[model samples]
Target: MRDQEPAPVERATRRLSTKETAELLGVKPETVYAYVSRGQLSSRRGQGGRGSTFDAAEVEALARRNRRESTPGSSPDELSVRTRITLIDEDRYYFRGVDATQLAARHTYEEVAEWLWTGTLRPGARFTAPKESLAAARRAVSALPEHSSPVDRLRVAAVAAATADPLRYDLSEQSVLGAARALIPTLATAPPLLRATYTDGAPIARRLWGRLSHKEPDEASLRVLDMALALLVDHDLAASTLAVRVASSARAHTYAAVSAGLGVLEGPLHGAASGLAHRMLVDVLDRGSAGLVVADELRAGRRVPGLGHRLYKGEDPRAQALFAALEELPAAHAALAAARDVVATTARHTDLHANVDLALAVLTTSHGMPAEAGETIFAVARTAGWIAHALEEYGERPLRMRPTGHYVGVRPPQPLPTQTGRE
Candidate 1:
């Protein structure tokens, strides 16, 4: 297939904010959108999803562009991001052009990680942690305060792993993958909460399960955990992945790039998505009425977390596959009931559908794990993806992700009018 064409030039005029664009077009702010939807104008999403910015040149030539008249079902306005990693389309997600849901069924997490990093499926890839690396991670985790969250322990472990590796400075594809193979497992096993005695050479999913829960997880639940890890291996250029690529583009080592990704992943708007969803599920189970809880949240003008996603027009396929898996487990019965009720109730009141965060929340809580367990799983799984992105970015021009800011601050060298000497 041919490469996607570049997005329209990102000229200075296109960088105008909503208010500026509205004034430029001599129309109300709302009407500016009417023009965009009609394709008379084009805009791209601004940083951090604050809003869209219009093309100044395109706005100036709007009359001429509109004369051609677009066909009934033309492509919607979108930013052209070039990558061979993952694809999100029509409510489904694919990794390396393979359906994620289908791949999750028969593939182990390590296998998927190999495929993402190398572009070929190697079923028996081993992601082994060195004894010395594990020791370093433990020391790092111990240095944190006792009350640190599991994710905090993970961050410290990442730094420790990087510092211990003398060869981490190499940025070759094989070198980066080798660093990632050791680093991910160290992060997973280093956390005090997840630390436990296990035989060497265990599958990552089984070893991880021992750390998350005191009870031994059944074989079926282990399979579920494996699938969850595999499915979350990548998701295009999410905010955290963007951070990884940015750090890599600047020639940072694999460890430094991953540290940047983890920093962004901890934000409430990113990796914490599953934790928030878990709280919503807890509220329903505690209140004994899913409908009442949903209604109250909506009445208070708060969004019911995990019920909707910006990417999927219908139910997130990941959620659908996970919910189907939950159906076969007796332990998930109560949590599943509450989850389904929330899904149905929200459907009646809004266009939102259940997303992957909700599915992950249900999976953890229903299996008698802590509410924060989902985030831990997410962090570990996404580490592979972050490494994959960092490798991809290392091949591109350096520092390309660095964006120039439109200065809206006060002008330089302006005199203070009050003569208070405040510059």
Candidate 2:
């Protein structure tokens, strides 16, 4: 009755610019361009040829494809060990089937150290010199420009070592493992930059990791360091690992791969927390009162830097292990001890646990090592895991992470202006 068949209401699918398309899809404009480059999207030019536009339907389909591709496996809650590393969402570190915290507490760091570098690296084995190829590595590091940060120093050293030894091209398992361990300490104490005014770097204290035996460093401190490394070693598909894997995908050598990982660590969000943790401890020590320190941090609207973890629901086992370990340190800072007590008592939850950061701060405070040492300590320890992971990635069939986009552009072309409508 109301206009019989009802007048057909024509609907025109709208077009969007690249920027608008990116916003709609929650991605960067460049990513959209990448999708276009890969032929995953389709676009057409306006009749006047101002700009190309894409069909909204095609764009939606591409977005759907991306969602399907990114969905996790069937058992999302279950953990999967990918490559050499095993991830339980965001809270564990494993080195070649070994639990990091267990090794850190039960065995010397050296044993854990050797295991990462070489899957076969284990404790109670006689140390063997591998031709001092790493010796040349020392000379390579000292030659970088003086302005390099610890990260750059590590990168430059890798490049230098890469140049000095022709043997790096060999990706044999034996060789990769050896490189992982040896380069660790080297990266920690690289040769001073050739051009800068800097103090001499520490020699790779070959026995330091060993000194963390149940005998010295107050078993408590070593425990803290161990837990810290275990927790810090890796995270699931973090920006850093993503960077490392990206490089690995190109079949870049291990050094380049590790170097790529370091690049991500150089960022403030990733590697700077160790520094922040160290400073927080220094503040507490300087204030000379742990209670005052916690109160001060709380008043300032700053949560204690090392007290909680993102994944552990406020009860980090590594932190628990470290707290137990801290009880055994030689002259551990009284303030840190007090702060730990304060945090346990006053925080929103009595359950707010100390994380690897606080644990590492305790270690550095007790050891009297340099303040920026945790980041380096972590970098060295994790190198083994990264290599192991890299090897695993290298062995897998390449997925070739190609970028794609949703095609969104201007309007369809308009006919050229006819003279007077063909008067």
Candidate 3:
């Protein structure tokens, strides 16, 4: 064969400055550095090796990926409510402009709740359940079926507590704050405790610990629980929070609005995720390997619970915080190891990261808490956020959340169908 001519050399690809890369990606220069740190984009020393530079092609591709991931395939008119509570940006979230994880690390759940309710963080803030409201809630929750989920019991308790408070209809900020403080503790103490110990004047987490676990909690475990509650107090307008907002837009009282949120939280995709994760962890521990349990789940056509979150691209921040806290407890070592194993085994098939649900599972499983304990914790913790959102919605025009139906059905012109009672 004839000798082939050497191919012409191609030009080197362009390298962009950090500012250019940030502009292309529609993010800040700091975010560009974050992307580099996360390995999403690579950077090289600039011309004289003074600054970093990124490949134009890689930056463009990353920008395209970001656009695709961010813009949802929903109508432009999709519900958008204005609020000044939580703000979720990329992997991190903030509460009233303060880092939520930092707050969780340093403050009690009550203080964080107070901060969310009012701009002021009250040191040593304690929420006390009124005797009448607590008694009513306990009676109503006790009347539920023995197998009722914690959320179900909570919903009942909210309604009963509402009935007990003659001022439930008061939507004034001060009145709502009072109701919120009272209602949170009432819900925390409503469920039947595993032990008969009274934690009347203790922090909400301490009161809730006795209800969720028979084992006495060490300080580390109690601290973890308190942090978990604080971290979970708010997360933008979640489905349940939106529900609470809608109820509040119609002028629902604090307890009623909170009940609306609790109702939505009972769905499998929401508050029930941790319970499922707990069960999965138990199965993994019993099977002696996460690989086997993960395989069974995939074989059953199920996505592994407690992995990945829509709002986070990396590991859930809440999960990171909880896992770090969990490491401090010697008792949580085994369950935490199992959770890590689950993450490692699943990574072979997909790139999902562990979310807060998995961390919650580790806590509940290691501490002898029931699978539903996570749900109870979520319900009690998120009640604070729900109250904040409800308070915000109360200030807006009534029924402002009502959306005009698009009328995609039979345009209201079809004749009434004949009665076909007996087929």
Candidate 4:
């Protein structure tokens, strides 16, 4: 809703960190960056070795302008009213007003992805021929190097499979989303790890061309992965979103936009932490107890990864959905069970609560999924959101991003034609 009048403007009192500026906009850093791209805000570059920060007052003013445009009585701005795809934000992300935790409880991965992509809750809306899709995905998996990480193989297969999508270029939101739903699962579940290869020396069969990969994935495991992917499908304006928007602003095609987002996702801030957390759980399990090991880590002042979120002071809502999914799995490793016990043991402070990352760690390990696959799964799932945000950004009016207070060095006069010896 529009603000009838500006709130009393406060004087520029302090420098705000990028994270703080992001909070002020009620959006993620990615969204604030969009504002920066539009010349709506100015960032200050400090002269010292420290990094740049923003003027709180300037950002507040920009935020105020946005608030005014959204005022209840005022007509919607053209940019806000654009009919492009909504990648990161959905309608409350609550299908039929039911939270995802409840939905994941009863539904399968196919059901959830369909619901997310189509906004339908019925099972019929899911893959009509899931068996065929599975077969094709399995065939694609062989294309990857067996000795290499299964996760890498999975990601490459997804990209390769997505290449067949002729309709990806269609600017229509419905068509693109339809493609995304079809692709997400085929990409999300990696082919069962080669049994003989791991147990004893063996070889792979000839690559099947679009042959269905009907290895009969552990249903519970897939459901957990699916739920995690769905919950994380979109978050408003993350770094990946910024990369997608920047690409789209250049009028790049949908695939290019998604590719840009995936590149950004490869970085630690956006996606790698999930696997690292899972690895930590493994380490504790390997040590036989979380007590001395965890204490030693804490003693060294080492902050563990994937414990919480930068934005969510409270428990991540997505985590609850993942935790529920993990519970439904019929078989979980002994190690996971031990980790759960340790987590409960320190409920007061360390229990702090698992985010989507920790939940995913629990889900994959319990289901016997490869450790390497976690980050890749995140990349595949979030690709849909990236494309959506990219399209939304393309329609926005052009704005220049200007950085200020960019000082180079102390002011020193240019040495007047220095004649070293004579002068």
> Best-fitting candidate, measured by TM-score?
3
Can you write out model 4's per-residue Cα lDDT over 1-423, one digit (the tens) per residue? Answer: 976996888865678877888777655565566567657777777668465578878977876664442445655432232222232222223433456555656764445555554455556344321445546666777666667453455555555555666665664556556655555545544455433111111101111101112234444544455566556656666787767776765655565666567667766666876777677677677787767656766788866555666656666777766665566665655645655654664565754655777776775565445565567667755765665565455434322111135579967786677566854
* For model 4, the run of ten residues with the poorest summed lDDT: 201-210
Question: Residues 1-423, candidate 1, lDDT per residue (tens digit)?
Answer: 999998997755437787887666555576577567645668899899989987767776653332222334554343233578899998888888989889888789999988888878897776788888889989888888988887788888899988889999987767888898898888778655554635667777877886777666788888888888988888888899988888987989998999898899898777888888898898999998788888787899878878787888898888888888878778888888888888888888678888888899888888777777888899999999999998877654455555546789998898777655656
Better structure of 2 and 4 per lDDT: 2
Compared with the true structure, the alpha-carbon lDDT of candidate 1 equals: 0.81
Q: Each candidate's lDDT (Cα)? A: 0.81, 0.60, 0.89, 0.56
| TM-score against truth, every candidate | 0.78, 0.64, 0.82, 0.59
Candidate 3 per-residue lDDT, tens place, 220-314, comes to 89999999999999999899999999899788899999999999999989999999999999998898899989989989999899999999989
Arranged by lDDT with the best first, the candidates are 3, 1, 2, 4
For model 1, state the Cα shift of residue 280 in Å.
Answer: 1.9
Query: What TM-score number comes out for model 2?
Result: 0.64
When summed lDDT is taken over every stretch of 10 residues in candidate 3, the lowest stretch is: 65-74
